[model samples]
Target: MSCSECGSPTIDFSLPERYRASLSTDAAVANCCTRCLTVEPVTDADTDASTPEFGRISDAVPTDQEQAIPLLLALELADSLATNRDAIESLLRDVERAGADPLLAIDRLARDPDLEPRVDLERRSHQIEQLLYYSNN
Candidate 1:
């Protein structure tokens, strides 16, 4: 499903079993947009019983790895840079344009021999790796 706010694709996830018992049929499943991060419940018609996989809803979502990598990079950069919204958006656009693999880029930045002694590159790189690991699993 697509996000109403940004028109970006969404990841569908089922509610936990404990919470599911309390929800009505209409609220059993929910989807969160990959880009905008808007979350809303899926309607009965949108629900599919055939796919019942639990946890890590992203696995079920068909995402473009090329696009996802840049988006993930943007999020990590924004957090690490602690920049304003406009600056974050600009950085995201730049990363998207560069189309470089985020993991490799972050690793390279972390290991740059002549890098300025400002923010902790190694810490940021580790956080990004953890973020990717947790999100995928």
Candidate 2:
């Protein structure tokens, strides 16, 4: 079956033994495409009887720098929008799916001396939180 997130047909249900225990069913294999699995781990709750083996993506924890980097970049980009409320809203959802700590990432971004204008980091961070919360709800 195709992956739920990216719809790629290359599904490898028999993931390495490491990822197997985390998953329950052969049918409910984490979507084959590494990109989908990499984005977030699939949890039991995300699976069910009817849907294709690939189910909802969970806020799987980021294990290392490679995993964390994309989330960090997504959080940073979320802060600066050039209009397009729709895109902003979409990006907010993507950031939420990323499952990174918005507050921490925003604070770090704000504190960066490299950032040209470092004004109102806290407020911007709060805005990001609000977007995440509101989007999720």
For each candidate, what is the lDDT?
0.46, 0.40
Cα error, candidate 2, residue 46 (Å): 41
TM-score of each: 0.31, 0.33
**Which candidate should be chosen as best, given TM-score against the real structure?**
2
Candidate 2 residue runs with Cα over 4 Å from true position: 1-82, 117-121, 135-137
Residue 17 C-alpha lDDT in model 1: 41
Tell me, what's the RMSD of every candidate? 14.0, 13.4
TM-score of 2: 0.33
The total of clashing pairs for model 2 equals 0
Give the Å error, residue 89, model 1.
28
